[model samples]
Target: MDEETFNISMRKFLKKVGVTSQQEIEKAIRAGLANGRLKGDEKLPAKMVLTIGGVDLTFAV
Candidate 1:
């Protein structure tokens, strides 16, 4: 694939990993919500990643 194609493919792969799509990320940002940028919608056990301060932030919420 070309450079552009590779970049797009990589972006999709990352999104599949953690729902890391541009729109969703942007929505989260606009809502002033940020827990862990790495953790996506439902790729893993959400509860496994405990809170650092005092917030039970789910992957979607």
Candidate 2:
């Protein structure tokens, strides 16, 4: 792929993933707050799993 095409596709993919992940996190946080599962000033443990083709990756957030 050309540099221009690769950059455009990468940016679009990253933006979509970033935005959707952020929205889901915010929704979860809101639910936690409503149910008294979380306080406004606490560090929450987070994890994420990603699978691509035959590879699996785990991340700590």
Candidate 3:
């Protein structure tokens, strides 16, 4: 495996995930606020799960 190629691919994937996830979260929050389901100043519990081959990881944010 070419380390440079793998690293570049991984970075691209992560960037796409980050950008799309942020957009989705923002849209959801906006909808929730509009519907009176979420207060503007609330701590929201969020979790992210990543699965790849034999690796499975969960992160709480």
lDDT of 1 by residue, 1-61 (tens): 5999999997886667566455665676655435555444544332223233467544433
Clash count in backbone of candidate 3 = 0
Which residue pairs of candidate 1 clash?
A: 18-40
- Please name the candidate that would achieve the greatest lDDT relative to the true structure: 3
Q: Model 2 misses residue 31 by how many Å?
A: 0.2
- Compared with the true structure, the alpha-carbon lDDT of candidate 1 equals 0.55
lDDT per residue, candidate 3, 1-61, as tens digits? 9999999999999999899999999999999999999989999988776667555654544
What tens digits encode model 2's per-residue C-alpha lDDT throughout 1-61? 6999999998998799889999999999999999999888999777766545556654444
Candidate 3 colliding pairs:
none
Relative to the true structure, candidate 1 reaches a TM of: 0.30
lDDT of 2: 0.84
Which candidate leads the pack in TM-score? 3
Model 2 spans > 4 angstroms off: 48-50, 54-61
